[model samples]
Target: MGRHSRKGPKSSGPDIEAATADAGADREAVRPVPGTGRRRRSVEAPAGSDGHTPFQQTGHVRGGHPEQREPGGGWGTGLQQLHRGDDHRPGARPTAQQQAAAGRQQSTGTRPLVPGPRREFVDAFDAPPAPPAPPAPRGPSIPPPRPADPSTSVGERDEQPPGGGTDGPAPAKDGKGAKGRTFTGIAAAAVTTVLAVVVAGQVTQDNGGGTTSAQPSGVDRLGPDGASRSDDRPTPEPVRAKPLSYAQKMAKAYPLAPELKASGKFEAVPGTAKAPGRGHRYRYRIDVEKGLGLDAALFARAVQETLNDDRSWAHDGAMTFERVSTDDPDFVITLASPGTTGEWCMKSGLDTTEDNVSCDSAATERVMINAYRWAQGSSTFGPDKLFAYRQMLINHEVGHRLGHDHVSCGTRGALAPVMQQQTKSLNIDGIKCRPNAWVYPPS
Candidate 1:
C-alpha cells in the first residue's frame, strides 16, 4: 500500500500525476527499522473520498499506521470483524479454510489482513424454518406381572401381594377354620361373664346384703383355734333385762320365816344420807344381822327416806333424820330375824315373840325391827297395804325410840297414829281405824 498525501487536492489531471509520483517516492522511502525487521510507517488522518477525516470515520484519532486495515476504510471495520461471528449467514456452518484462518489468527495474535467476501444480509423471516425437534423419546412401557414363587417367604418375595394379602394357603371354602375360631372366642367370653356373675353373687351372700356391714375392730373375726368364724350372718346383740322402777320395788314383798333365827352378828350399812331439812336433826345407824339374806341397802335407804319424810316424825320441820355409819348415833335401827328380834326385844323387857313384832330395845341403842315383819305385812295391814305397812313398821319402832308411846284412834274410820302399834292392831278396841304410815297423814 502507498501512503496518501496530506495536501489539498489540486487540478484533477495534475493531481493524478503528482499522486502517482508521490506514491513511488513513498514506496522507496519505506524501510524496516533495525532489529525489528518490520517496516515502520507514519499514519496520517487523510481525508476520505467522502471528504471526512479518519477521526470523523472512526470517532477516534488514528496514531501510527497499523500493519493492515480493513479495505472499507477506518479501523472501526477491523474492530467490527473481530466481534462479528465467523459465519455471517444464519444456520450456516464454517468452512475448513475459515476455521484454519481463525486458528492462525488466534495463534499469531492478529486479525486477518484480508477480509473475506462481503456478507449479504438476509431477512430473518425469509430464512428457512428450523427442522421440527425430533419427538421426545417415548417412555419404556410397563412389563407384565410374573407368577409368585411358593418357595419364597412373604418378606423375601420381590413383590408383595396387593391389599396385604396373606401368603399362607387360603382356608377351605367349607368355613370350618373360621367357625372353630369364632366358637372358641364366644365360649371364652361366656365363661368369663359367668365367672364374674358367680363371684358377685357369692360376695353379696357373704356380706348378707348389697352393702357390707363393718365389723367392730375390737372383735376377733377368727376363732381361738384359728378357724374363720361365720360372718355370713351378723351376730345377734345380747338381750338385757330392764331395771325395776322404784314403785315396783316398793310394791313387791320379800319372803322370811317368822320363826327363823339368823346369825346375830351385825354389819353396819355403808354410806350416809344427809338430813334434807333445816330442822332438829336426829342421826341413826342401820345394822343388818349377817345371814339375813336381805337387801340391807334397800332397808337402810327406806329407813332414811321414811324418817325424813314430810309426813313422818319430820313433819312441819319438827325434825330431820340422817343415817350414819359411825358408832355414835341417836339410835341404831336393827333389822333382824324374828328370833334375833325376840332376843334383842327381851333386853328392853318387851316380848315380840308372840306377834313377831318389832320394838325399841331401849336398854340397848338398837331399835329392833323383825325381819319377818319387815319382809311380810301384818294381818291388820294385809298385802294390799304392804308398802304402807312397811313404812308404819319403821316409824313405829323409831317413834318408840323417840320416846313415843302407843296410841289408838279415838274415832272409827280415822287414820291411826304412826305410834299406834299399827302392825299389831289398827282396829284396837273395835274402833276400826284406818291404817296410816305417816305421823301426820294427809288430811
Candidate 2:
C-alpha cells in the first residue's frame, strides 16, 4: 500500500500486469517517480537453490548481494528473521526507539514493553565464570582441640579487659558453656564451680584503661603454694576499693530479703597442712542479714580466718574445711542484704539486685554474701581491703562451694584468680591481674 495515485500516474490508469500481480511478483516493483506519484517497494535476499549468498549460506558472504555482505560476526539467521520489519508495517512511522517506547507506554499506563534485561552469563564476552561454593565438613571433638597453651582460659577468658585485662582465651564453647555449661560443662564447672551466682554476688577493679577502681589489702592473704605467714612485707599497694557502680544493669531476675539472721551457732575453724594427705573435706555454715548493718562476729571472723588459712578453699591437701550450725551444711555462708542477696541468690540459678554482688549456690548450699560485697569491699579489694575482700569472698564463694571454675589471671600482673571475676572487672578478659585473693597467691 505505498500510497501514490493523485488519480493519475500508475502509467496513467491502473493494471500494470494487475498492479504487478497484486504487489508480490517477488516484490521489487517501483517505477513511479517520473512525475512524483511515488512508489518504492523492495524484498530481495532470496537465491538458495545452492547458488549461495544467504551470506554465502551462513559462512560469511563471498560473492556479494546478501544485503551487500559485511555483517558476519554477531547476529544471523540471515540478520535476524531477515531484517525484521524493514520499517514495521500497518501504518508504520514510529522509531526514535519507537517514540521512546511510546513515552514509556504512555507513562506506564498498563505497562507492557519490558523486554531488554537478559545479559549475564557472566556478562558474556565469551562466558565461563561461576564456580566457587563447596567447603564445610570437619567433625569429631570435645574441649581439648584448641590448646597450644597461650594460657588456656576461655569463656572469652572471663571477659573483663580494657584496664583489667586477661589477654584472650575464648574458644571453649559448647552448647552454652562458661557460666552456663558444656565444653565438658566448662571443664566440669572448672573443677567444681558448676554454677553458683550470688554466694556473695559482686565487686570490681580495672586498670588497663577503662575506669572502675578500688584495691586494698595484701599484707597477707595466703597461698605461697599453700600457706605460711609472718606478715611477709611488700604487700602494700592497698586502699582503692569502692568507686565503680554507675549502676543500672539489672534484669535476669531480682528482689529479696524479706528478713533473715544467724551469725551465731556455726563455729569451729582450724585445719590445714596444704593438700595434707590431699583434697576433699568440705562442711560449712555462717549467717547474718537481720537488716544488715553487718559484722556478724566480723563476718564470722572473716570466714574463720579465711578458711583455716592454708590459703583458704583448703588449697592443696586437695581440700578440707569444717564450720557448722548444721542445716545439713556442706555450704551456707549467708550475709544477704542487697535484698536478701536477690533472695538467697535466686536459689542458685542466680539473678539481679546486684548490691555490689556475691552469689553461690551449687543448688542452694547457699553462699549469697553481698551485704554490698560484705560491707564495702570490691573495686577489687581497694579500700580497707577488708582483709583482701574477705579473701576474695572466701575464695570466690568457696570456689563455688568446691566444684570450682572461674579462673583468668593467668598472666598480666598475675595473681588474681580465686576463680577470677574479682568482684566484677579485672580486665574481665583483656587480661590484667594483681589483686588476687589466692588460689595460689603468696608468690
Candidate 3:
C-alpha cells in the first residue's frame, strides 16, 4: 500500500482537481439558484417560542448568528429535554430568586439546619421564638393546719362544750354534723321506743284488769217501794199457740228445707210475719220484731238454696229461725227494735208499762241482728250478693247446729263451711270467699 501511494501522489492530485471542476460545471448546468421575492413562513412555532411570535428563519437575518437570535422565550431546547414532562416547561430557566434559593439549599447540604421545629408559614414575618421548656410537676399543696394531739384525729375528739364555743381554744370540727344527726336519730329512736312501751303497757293494763266496769243501763232501777229493783221488772208475755209444723206454703215452694231429709234435720225454718197469716198447719204468730235485718223470706230462701245445693255434697241440714217477741228461748233471735214504748207486742199479751223496752231476754230465742244496720249502708253488695252473704251467715250457724267444729284455713283462700264460727272469726272482709276460690274442700 505504501509503494502504490508513492507512484500516484503528485500526478493524481491535478487529475482529481480537473474532475471536480467538471462535476461542478455539470451541477451548475443542471440546477440554477432562484431569485427570491417573498418567503413562506414555517408552520410549527419554534421550540421554546413562548407560543407568541410567528416562526422565523433566523438564518435570513443579515450578519446575525441564528442560534443566538432564535425566536424563543422562557427556557430553551436543552431545558425542554432535561426537564421533560415536568411542570416547569422544557426551555424554562430559573429566575434570580430561584437561583438564589438553589444556592442557599446547596450551601446547607439539604440537612435542616433549624435547631427545632420550623415555624408555620404564618410565623415567617417574625423571628422564631425559643420553645418553652416543660414545667416540673409540684407535689400536692396543703397549708399548715392547726396542731392537734398526735394520738387522735380531730373527729376522734369530743364536741366543744356549749360555753367554750369554737374559738381559738377549740379544735377543728370534722364529724360535728354527723354526730349531731346521730344524736338526733338516737333520741328519736329512744322516744319512739318509750312511746311504744307506754302504749304496750296501757294495752296490757286494759286487757289484764278483769272487771268490766258498770256502764249504766238507763232503766228504772228502783221500784215504788224505793228498794233497788234491777231484777224486779214486771214481765208478762204469752203468745198465741202456733203449731209445731212444716214451713209455710211459700217456704215449701222454694225448697226451704231440701236438706232436711238428707241430714235428717231441718235447716230452713218458717219465719213468722209481723202480722198473723192464714195457714192450715200452724196459725202463724206475729212477733213485733220478727224479720228484722234482712228480707226474712228471701234470707230464708237463700239458706234453703244453699242447703239444697250442698245436700248431695255435705248433707248439712237446714237451720230454723224464730222470733223473740213472746218470751226468751234458749238462743235469742233478737231484732233491732227501736221505740220508747215498753212492750214486746201488745197483741202478744206483753205489758207496755216501762219507759223504754229493753232487750227482752225472756222473749229471746236464738240469734239477733240490728235491722237498722241493714237498712243503713251496712252492705253495699246487691240482692244476689246479699243473698250470698246471708247464705254464708246461715251456713255458719248451721255448721254449729250440725256439730261441725270451727276450723281455720291458716293460709288465705275461700271460707270453708267448717270455719263457721260467725262472731268468733267473722272476718269475711279480710278473706276472699268466692265459689271456686274456696280454700278447703266441701265438708
TM-score of each: 0.48, 0.19, 0.22
Off by over 4 Å in 1: 1-230
Candidate 1's clash total is 0
Judged by TM-score relative to the true structure, which candidate is superior, 1 or 3?
Answer: 1
Each model's lDDT comes to 0.65, 0.46, 0.33
For residues 1-443, write the lDDT of model 1, one tens digit per residue.
Answer: 22322233222333334433543543421111011112222222335666543221111112222212112221212212322323211211122233233334444555345433234323444678999999866732333456664533343243233212232222333467557656766776776787788889888978676666667988767756776687556889899999887556666788888889998999999999999988899988999999988889888878888888898888889989888899899889999999998998998899999877888999999999899888878888888878888888898888888889988889999988888877778678878888889988888
Q: Across residues 1-443, which tens digit of lDDT does each residue of candidate 2 receive?
A: 22211121122112223333433543432211011112222212223344431211122111211111111112211112123323211211111222233233334443222233234422564667668878755632333433332321232234322222222222233324244533445565554442233222332222234443454565444546656454555677879876433121110112333233333232323332222234666666676656454446555655665676676666566666656665676667777666656766677667845434777866766677776555556666576455566667777876776667777776877667778777777775577876777666666
| Stretch of 10 with least lDDT, candidate 3 | 1-10
Which candidate, 1 or 2, would have the higher lDDT against the true structure? 1
Q: Pick the candidate with the highest lDDT.
A: 1
Q: Which pairs of residues collide in candidate 1?
A: none
Candidate 3 has an lDDT of 0.33
Clashes of each: 0, 67, 19
Model 3 lDDT tens row, 45-105: 2222233332211112112111111111212211111122322111111222222332343
> Which scores greater on lDDT, model 2 or model 3?
2
